[model samples]
Target: MKNDSGAVAAVKARANIAEIVGRYVTLRPVGSRLVGPCPFHQETKGSFNVHPDKGFFHCFGCQASGDVIDFFCRINGLEFREGLERLAAEVGVDLGRARSDPRAAAKKRERDACLAMHELADRYFRHLLGRDEGRVAREYLERRGVSAEMIERFSLGVSPEGWQGLQTVLRGRGFDDDSAIIAGLLTQGKNGRTWDRFRGRLMFPIRDGGGRVIAFGGRVMGEGDPKYLNSAETPIYTKGQHLYGLYEARPVMAKTRRALLSEGYLDVITLHQFGYGEACGVLGTAMTHEQAKRLSGFAPRVDLVFDGDAPGRKAALRAAQMLLTLGGACRVVPLPDGEDVDSLLHAQGRDGFEACLERAEDGLNFCLRMVRESYAPREIVAWAGEFLGGLADEGLRALFIPRVASGLGLAEAELRRLLSRPAKRPAPGPRPGETAAPRQPAWELAPRDAQILSFVVRRPDYAAHLAGAGAGELLGNADARLFFARLAGLVSDEAEARLTEPETAFWAKAQMEPPVSDEDAAAFFEELCVFLHEARESDRRRSVMDAIRLAQQRGDSEEALRLLGELQALSGRGDE
Candidate 1:
């Protein structure tokens, strides 16, 4: 099931344990070994000890002892087989697993075909830039500060305007139109015709984490409706799932454990050109749970550098929320109004850019700032609940609770009570010349609901034990439901398989609170289950009350009486 041979052994032999571990942790030489903060588990004091000479490392605090292979597995959340493949790729070793597994052979063939098409398209587009037709695109890039070296290093390309320009080349090279379309290089028209997907545009190849081109984002050279266009979702490419310059940003992100996220292709290029190699861009979309989770894998934190426009600020807030939810660290660097990273870097250079980073605020504080500006004093309690309820650490939550209460002008006990319940949404406002509708209170998950789910995510062993006892069946939160469904798939004895992006994001959010140890698991698990049951019953009671009110409003006495009986039974009260 794994690559046991020439590649894996060579990767291990060539890999320096200290260098590899240093990518995620800052290691200082301590006697014969290097010690740094452990990333696999949460800790303040650095107890993770690494023996570079022996090619093995051990975390004294958490007892996470591992060799290079095991270290990669834990740090990257990969199984042994996947980690081997990634390490092999890193060290430039051929995996040669296709010969052993038919499934692997089939997957390899499909991916290779797609890669070949991308390579050909990249070359064709670059060659097009050399033609007279690309003069406009070239001028545009040069104006945007893209140098000749950058164009080559980034494999920048230009798509010609003709309908069948790229189609002609692919067909001549024995590649079918179907293959081109599947690879996201060609588009078919409504009249049973196919042509180039990108035309008269500057093309930016979107590479995957492994540095292979999977898709393209095309920006129009002149006036156009879309301004920028991206390739459609294909088997190999999902825009929100990959960052623009991650392939180039990998080494730098690894070394710094930080990434600078921007909004456009040129922003990333310009930043990298000016010695900011840790910069990358979101692929033609808002920051997603998947994107946040993916970037967090390489770096501990991502500093968002977006334009200071209303839309840009809104996007930053969304990104901050997603990162906060995922339990990943993030900082927001507010740029001047009407200034983007590309323009700012070109005008001010690295010094100016570093200045902005200096003023950056933590994700939580940035989000809280936004809430304070928009929400009323009374509305702040529910908003704070939504914000602070995601923090997994009780001690940290304890510290923030009073601060938040003081800021909102509420008592700590009152704020804590508000957080223990589901947050309420504001009612819709009245339309012009119309009376306002009465707002109905909506039901949401209680803080206890989040606590139980977080506990399960942090302790998969607990999840497995709870599932055996039918604990998952009692969960009502949509997010919690999705998590338990995925957890069921990874309940095997040796289950170290990675969860999907959304699941991973939820897991990260759950990570805010530390996990209960095996010694305390029984007591803690019982308490959480009791709290969940109580929450569910509370929701059920609310539903019954809503039903009674609706029935009575409709003048249906029979129905109202039946609901009242059910409610009384639930409340353990006899009808008089």
Candidate 2:
């Protein structure tokens, strides 16, 4: 881990933050900093600021701030390690010694190999789609109105009817049977013979947030038992962790801050073809919390474009509940019965699709309507209780409670009481190998504390003076105290690496703030010292008053009188 940290610091030191950020945001010089519209959210004004000298970016509008690694991770939907590796590669840094542990190094190599195999498999599938053997699959796609451009964009491919087609390709490419099987490109039979996992089907390559091919989903082109077959859980890809078409849709979604979430692969492709570039699909599984969170990172609002049948409606309801609980805005776009995004777009084109979107209903309202229509009164209450219980935010829960109550024909008070009852716990505790979530540090600071910290951050020379005045004791927030303690001795640039997750945004924003003048900083420091002294005295006075009341209540008159005398002496000193 020490070596890893060293590697991370080396990468950060070498990588140009502005150059990386400029890829996503068109930045213009603003004094010493660069300014651009925030890629994290939709904004007209250039509130996102990049400090090339400091190697960090901050958005005043959304308060999104971090270093280059943070920017890449957030924008690409990657984890810290993945982002570090990717950036390290880009910056031409060697991480070989950083991953010195043989076991960890081996694991990394295995994941890399799996990813490489998937890429090869993707290329093979695409090649086959252009070959003469792919005539059937190509015809099916043509009839479905899938254009050549879309086919290329999505890397659409086909597996021939024979089992050894992909197997032969992988073997020739030097991928062994075990590795190919692990990558989900080949399956072994009971007779101990390995064959292609996706035969006679249209293949959709699944990629990670960084656009690395990791897995595939294959839909049968002709009559078959299972219409769709997806890659099993692989080292590089999980079932529900990644969404289809997200890599293609990310840029548009970032600009729009909205996404059209549908069910099937064709639905997503069709949506993208029809100019809804901010469209993605779930990977053949029910919407998970991880997927919802990933989508919310790029787009605050998601429009559910699932099929208009009963099962699709049910899926939409579940997805809407999850998104609402996560504090994401969403709408349910209703297509005609038996119509999906693909069928609707093809039959009536963009105008029809736009009309359906125009009729989209709020996610919560959709949930309520569905509950009211499908569930009986008792069931509706249970459903509402379950839904409300899942909401961790009390304010958000309160806002939705009234609507749920009204829709269910129950009094708000009754609904509240029902929710108040002890409900079944979803999980008894953290599962094996999973630790309980850490308690978050209080990130908010009181106004005075914020002012004090802000001044100290801008003018680090005054930190010693503020500390000498017992400013740390007067600070209310734990995060503020920790931040001051950690960064008081270091320069602002040095403080960036020391920040905790809770402190990163604040630190970045403080760095981007206008620098304080020497005179202004001195005056503010003195004023802050005096304020802290007065605040400390006030607190002491209040404590003594409380003691005096307790003494009087206990009939300890002498003690009470003595305390009063001390209080009088203090007041006289203040007056002097």
**Clash tally, candidates in order:** 2, 0
| Per-residue lDDT of model 2, residues 450-520, tens digit only | 77777766776777777778888877866678677755642232223356665677667677678888888
- How does residue 568 of candidate 2 score in lDDT? 70
Clashing pairs in 2: none
True-structure Cα RMSD, model 1: 14.0
Candidate 1, residues 1-576, lDDT tens digits: the string is 011245555777887788888876778888987888776544455788887765667776545665576677666544566577678778777866455556655765665677788888988999989889889988998888898878887889999989999989889888899988888889988897999989899999988655678899899988995888998877667546678998888788756777899999999999889988999998757876567766775666789998888788778987887676555678999887778989998999889888898999887777777777877876676667765776656766787788777765668888877667644533223323234434444434456556566777567666666776667667767555645655654322222333433444344444435557876778887876686678678888899999999999999999999999998888888655
Report how far residue 63 has shifted in candidate 2, in Å. Answer: 6.3
Most lDDT-accurate candidate: 2
User: What TM-score goes with each of the models?
Assistant: 0.64, 0.74
Candidate 1 vs. true structure, TM-score: 0.64
What value of lDDT does candidate 2 attain over all alpha carbons?
A: 0.81
